[model samples]
Target: MKMEFDLRMTQEQKLIMTQQMQMSVKILQMTNMEMQSYITKEIEENPILETEKKSKEKKDDIDYKELIKYLDDDFNYSNKNYYVNNEEEVSPFTFISAKKSLKEYLIEQVIDLNLSESLKYLCMYIVEDIDSRGYLYTNKNILAEELNVEISTVEEALKVIHSLDPPGIGGVNLIECLKIQLNKKQITDKEIYLIVENYLQSMADNKYAVIAKELNISIQEAQRYGDIIKTLEPKPSRGFYTGEETNYISPEAHIKKINDEYFVIMNNDEIPKLNINKTYKNIIYNDEDEKTVKYVKDKINSALFLIKSINQRESTIFRILTKLVEVQRDYFDMGEKYLKPLTLKELAEMLQIHESTVSRAIRDKYVYTDKGTIKIKDLFITGIAQNNYDDNVSTLIIKKEIKNIVESEDSKKPYSDQKICDLLKEKNFNISRRTVAKYREELEIKSSSKRKRY
Candidate 1:
């Protein structure tokens, strides 16, 4: 046996994701708002990058004939009557009432409180730390350490926060929050407070008899106490706006039906158009210093690459949406009942792109259709085969059917999972009792026993 080192050469192909490629992938996966922010940041950093400006004069110029021609050829605008006057066009910037956020509301209340600067700052810190659910889950000791203050001082600030507007805003947990609200209401009943503090779980489970026996009260009295507890707001910030504001989704593309033919319209209105800055371009072109020219050249290249990547992202999204519309034509024409089962892998194979690419393209993207504005990901659903095996039906459709059946069932004798399965089978859905139960659970529907009314 000879122990010898052997050297061999082998040829293999592999993909190495470059920095530019990674950036492109990131840009592809970004939502519209994220992409806008990213682009704005890029423009701020790189002087060579600028957003293309459309002047009001340029926009209002009388060129209806050319516009109509372009729309017909590029956008497939068939109906002439569909063309609307500019006056009738709805402005995207319609009136929206701005609501003060929970943090803002708390801060305003804290400011009015006459306290030392240190205490005020600490109170604000505690208020800021309160979560969207209007609860301060952060440990007082940890907060003290982070704020570089005494634990006693932090505790005082927390006490102040608990006393602020929107009762139960600074509680540590659900039970504590309820207790805080009860305290604010000056609830004198010790039994009610004890029930909230100790037997919240029992109350939640509707163990009224247990609560009655434990509290030495009748079941009806327990029920009355339960009703009082129910009146207390679980979520203190329920009506108040949290930090997470409602983001209005702008569709990337639209599937419009024109003259019995569906046309895919890419939405470019919302997305900012990028163009190389003419001033920077000229400076780079005429600069004598090699270093300066090189610096400008690098920035120019980066800006160009970013523009190209954005274009690629838009085109990819458009293609995916077009393919989706084509496959789910029945769904578009009708409703959820006609939606077919689809998978990312199947779509990737059909589009000749990687499954991850398909996922990235559809991530946070939306499409406006004759039906409604729908999330791109919602269009692709795992399906189950029908009894006839003619076509696959989306699990969403199955859920919808299950919901309908449950909705129409006799309340006194609600359908069981097995009965629901049988009913679905009669409707050509090949599903088991377990599958029916799973679907019911997903729909948040209770079991037949729970749903049944005596």
Candidate 2:
């Protein structure tokens, strides 16, 4: 037997991702605000692109009849108008005064107290060290080393911070924060203070009987003190801004019902229309130098690709939403209860596109429906098997059912996880007791014992 090396030639077909293709994918995944920022940056960098301006004369000559006809043809909906202004008017005072941060508020209170220059400086340092949750976790020794002072001095500064206007602003932990608030309020109940300091875990677990026995009190008394402790603020800086502004979500599409038929509408109007600059186009056509011509050609190609990518993104999103509405028509007619289980793979197969393409199309995108603004991805949910129903139900539907059951339960004797599981089974959801507990925890619902009231 002999071994010989054999060589053979074979042709293979492979797809390589081009730079423009990558750009298109990136643009497809960007949210509305992100796409706006990206386009603005591109326009500033490239001299061959400009945003198209709408003329007042053209706007004035708009025909309502033709517009309605076009919409009817595209969406197969009636010409009934449903647009209404739902935005509430904001108070002028809201814009007049900027929000005061937790740090600034603390600093202002510190200024009102008379202190030595060194102490005031130390107080400022402590104030700055407090986290967004209004808790100071920095070690006194480390702070003293940084400020070139004794550990006792840092401790003194912390004490001063603990006395600030927000009762629990400078506490080191949840227990300490509660103690600080209790002390500030002059709460003289020794049992309440001791429970907060020692048996907070037992209290959270609803071991009220054990706590009462340990403290030589009745379970009712323990529950009454626990209720008082619940009134304390866990997050002292909740109302204060942390140098971050609220982000407003803009829906990328809309689903409207007209005469019992649902229609999908893409929000192309929010995006600015872009076109190649006439001057740059003329320069590219008239150029003779190879280097200058190449530069202009590259920029022009980039601008063209960006514009095409924007249009393609919108078209792809519209197609995906159209397919979604077709499949989930029951969801649109009824509510989330009727939402069917869907997956990117299934939708991609229906559209004859890659699963990743479907993912990119729905990334950070939202849709406005009769149910209000909802993330596009939220529409796709995994299905769970049901004993009674022919088809599987969505996990979201199960969660909604669990939430409803908990909401309607008696507060004095809340349903246990096992009881909840039995109730869901009666409703056709054959789920286990453990799964019910897991879903309950995910919904932030406490255990039956913890939810019990005296």
Candidate 3:
């Protein structure tokens, strides 16, 4: 073996991600609210960057106005009579009411109980420990020791807590919560009770036959009662204010149909327009001190690049959405059934950009349409082939068809995946039984055995 140690020179090219380029990609991926926060933080730290206030451009005056109108009727807040008249029927939209917290509601109910004062106080203390999920998560032994009371006394107070309204509140576990709710409803069905008490996990796994055998009932009968169990609320504190705020999705763009053409309209209300601070303008490298000149130069470059990155992000989104509108015209014009199959790679090729660029453009972003607000990524569905045809059908359309078929199916003899696939064949969706099963799983639809009812 000869060891060759000759010095050689070769030319090579590699893609390097610069700081500004990385920032641009991040800006591309950010949702509108996130972008707003980022810009605000940048404004605070970077002196050279200031938000540009446009005078006559007249952009971003509205945000979700149409959405609110579409969702609910225009509520009149100027009605003075709502406060004045107690006899008039109070409409839901008449006013915003200060709702009682769960703690307050439970405490108020406890106060009204004809119990001893000490007992009532103990119950209140236990109520204070009930978690947002309406379950008593604290250990009873520890609580009893802390309160200097016997475990039996704490158990007695918990019994009182269990009797409170919102039937499932104060349960130590899921089983207890469900039992409490069932007791309140006067559900004396022994089988259903047994299902809740013992077979809850089995029921979740859709093992109806196992439950039927254990309860000495027919498999069909088990599922019939299982339907009733499905109606029970798991989260008792749901819809009640649990001190946690729920953030709603706000779309970044709207697609509108004017005449026969569809157009993409940007939601600009929250996105801040940027400009270099006019006070610091032309101050870059024009200062008396060399240090000041260097400082100004660096800051100015950063500010300019930040502005450019944001602009580029917006432009890219606009181009992508514009193309999306053209591509998904059928979905917008007709219904979800007409949705075309498109993928990030296919769309990236169509727009002559990298697949990752398209992914980042739509990541965590939503767009409003005549149908409703939907995730931008929802538009990019993989195609399913039709029987002996060049055109491919969207998996979305196929999924919808599958859901409809399942919904209309005879519960006693539910369609198997093979049967479902055969049914779809009549509609020209040339998918296999395995593909049907995959789609069924994705839709969260139960299998033939699980779906069967008495």
Candidate 4:
């Protein structure tokens, strides 16, 4: 081997992620509330940036929608009354009021029941011991021993606790939870009680034949009663305030049809519309201290870049969504069932950009459509070969079909994965058995063995 060293000129072109490009990418991905918060922080840190005041003048009876640029000098998206038809929507906090928590509600009911002092104190102790899942975390025997009372007395308190609102609030276990709710519903069927007590595991395993042998019923009847059990709530605390905060969705854009034309509409009510401060602009030009002038200029450039990046984000989102309305026209016109096969790569190519650019443009962004407010990325669906006619099927549609098939199949003779594949093929879907199994799993449908009745 020989050691060699030489100075040579090399030439190769490569892509580089610049600061401005990074900001553009970041702004594109932020949700509406996120963008608003980001702009507010930027305004606070940069003296050159200030939020432009919205005009208070009224424009009456406009009653129309149009697609337009967001950052133009004539931007009027802030006129909520004119564009949104006085929808008068407010922030989620506006709807927030003091709510009574589950434990608090339970304690209040126990107090109002006017029970004897001993029973009241016992009920209060049990209510305080209940967890957020509505389960009595402490054992009844343990509580009885602690209170120096009999187990029957604790059970009597438990019966009173279980009789409160939200039917299953004080159940000690899942089985007890189901029984409490079923009791409240007045379902006196012996078959349901047996299934709840002795055949729960068998029911879960779809051993309806074993259940039928024990219950003296047909397989069909077992299946029917099992179906009823599935509807019961396992978590009694559902739909109640549990001290957990909820994250609300605020859509970034509205896709509306105006006179048979689709438009990307945005609102600036919460978003800060930024502009350079005239005082800072004057200081930059006249300040004697070079350091001060330099600082002002740097801040001004930063503010301008931020504003430009935000504008670019709005425009890019508008163009992509406008094109989406064209590419996924069937989806918008029909529903989710017609959402065609599309990928970020394919959409990037169609828009003459990189895949990462499309990915960033849709990241965390929400769009309001006729169907519902949905994440923008959900519009891009993976495509599958639908049939001989070359039609494409969305994986969403495939999952939907799998769910429908499972729901409609005979419970006593459930179809296997292969049988489900054959059924899809009969309906012009060309997926394999494994693919069927995958989609079935995604739909949370169990195997044929587990789905079958006795």
Best by TM-score: 3
- For residue 410, model 2's alpha carbon misses the true position, in angstroms, by 7.3
For residues 324-353, write the lDDT of model 1, one tens digit per residue.
889989888888777778899999999899
Residue 409 lDDT (model 4)? 91
The sequence of per-residue lDDT tens digits that candidate 4 reaches over residues 1-454 is 9999999999999999988677877787887778888998887788767766632322222121221121123233331221321233422223335556898889899999978989999999998889878889899989988999999999999999989988888888998899998999999998898899888998888888889988899988998899999998888887667766345467666777778877666644567777666565456446799888777766766776686677767767777887888998888888898888999998889989888878887887777777767888889989889788667888998889888888999977999999999999999998999998888887788899887654
**Cα-based lDDT for every prediction:** 0.79, 0.80, 0.78, 0.78
Error of 3 at 331 (Å): 1.7
Per-model TM-score versus the true fold: 0.69, 0.68, 0.76, 0.68
User: Per-residue alpha-carbon lDDT of model 2 for 1-454, expressed as tens digits?
Assistant: 9999999999999999999889999999987768888888998999867777732233334342343332212222233222222322221112224557889999998888898888888999898888888888787888989989999898888888988978898888899899999988899999999999899999889889999999999999999999989899988888787675455466776677779887676555546767666555445457777778777767766776786788777777888888899999888888888889999999999999999999999997888777878899988988889996788889888888999998899988899998999999999898999988888888888888889876
Provide the RMSD of all predictions against the true structure, rounded to 1 decimal. Answer: 8.1, 8.2, 11.0, 7.6
User: Higher-TM-score candidate among 1 and 2?
Assistant: 1
Off by over 4 Å in 4: 1-4, 12-23, 36-165, 170-183, 186-203, 207-226, 240-247, 275-302, 335-338, 390-404
Candidate 1 versus truth, CA RMSD in Å, comes to: 8.1
* Model 3, span 192-294: residue lDDT tens: 9899988988887778899999899998788877878888777787756667643446576777677988767676566777765554534542557767766
Pairs of residues clashing in candidate 1: none
Full ranking by lDDT: 2, 1, 3, 4
Span of 10 residues, lowest total lDDT, candidate 3: 79-88
Which of the two candidates, 1 or 4, achieves a greater lDDT against the reference?
1
The local lDDT score (0 to 100) that residue 155 gets in candidate 3 is 88
